[model samples]
Target: MVNPLDHPLFARVSHYINLINFLVLVPTGFLIHFPYTGAPINLVRNLHFIFMYSFLINGFVRFYWSLFSKHKDLVSGFLWNKHDLKTFWPQIKYYLFIGKQPNNPNKYNPLQKTAYLSFPVLALLQAATGFILYKPEKFGGVVSALGGMSAVRGMHYLIMIIFLAIISVHVYLVFTEATEMFWLMFFGKTEHKKGI
Candidate 1:
């Protein structure tokens, strides 16, 4: 049994590490600005920045590492295509309980591809706006381009909300739609009747 040349093992390892950053960043983003948190705003800001760095570093590293990976599927699976669009209808029907699940699914379904691919993009947008909000004077041009510091803040906040919502759905789908997925992601293997 020859294993597929492109294993997702390393990419999967990087993925869980990347998810940890969001887990902390989302809460801190709200807690820092929450009127009732009663905690020092700077403390929450510092915590949020820490996770931001981790997220950026992990994302950058995974992207660069994927370039040299033998297992290209790990990197390529996030790309959306015509096939993904074709597959999307059945996935929608499956979610609505009107279609049977796809038996031999690709590395991801269309919705998963869309969600996973959007994370880094949204993160980068959030990061750029965050930095601008962090030092408006330094990014005065960007602040003005985005309308103003308040607008930048609103964009950053909106990105956070979207990230949290997508992540919540992602987690629920991974656990419920196929519990084997969780184990496969964690252990990098599963007992399939045939090949992965």
Candidate 2:
């Protein structure tokens, strides 16, 4: 029997585009937040906005693809449910190296589902705060609603930290639990065991 495709080419391409855009966005954003030494703040700010748009557009593409693609079941599985509750602990233990990998029919385990679903929300927050910071005059209402510019800046920085943490764990799990999946995601094909 043939194994099903874990990630379609469109999904794979979108994944890399988001990854690349994120990789650029973080450093540029950081520089914008904390500048030093003839940093050419204008140039960095422009780069950050450019990559931010790219990331958002890629995210939109992935969302659209997930809704209408043959693998739409993945979106349905994105939510938490009683079944996910039951499997959550086992999945955690598997990650902690204290238990076997839980048998999950879906491509993602409970933890993965939760983390993956959160990206869009976090991305939107990051973008909102970013825009507010970028144009305080125009977004004065938003800035005030979010408790002033300081709060908006703090939120944008905090969201960046959260993204860093999530990406770190994601990369760790990919290398530790299912190395081949990373290759499959990147190259769109790889020989691997059925479950992984």
lDDT of each: 0.77, 0.84
Report the Cα lDDT for residue 39, model 1. Answer: 77
List the candidates' TM-scores in order.
0.82, 0.88
Clashes of each: 1, 0
The segments of candidate 1 whose C-alpha lies over 4 angstroms from its true place after superposition are: 1-8, 35-38, 74-76, 98-105, 187-196
lDDT of 2: 0.84
- What stretches of model 2 exceed 4 Å from their correct place? 1-4, 73-77, 97-100, 192-196
In the range 11-74, model 1's lDDT, one tens digit per residue, is 7778788778877888888886674646778878998999999999898888777566565554
Clashes of 1: 1
Residue 118 error, candidate 1, Å: 1.0
- Residues 1-196, model 2: lDDT tens digits: 1133767778788888988998899999889878999999999999999999999998887887788877765457687777788899999998888999878876678998989999999999999888888889998777888899899989998999999999999999888877777768876556465554
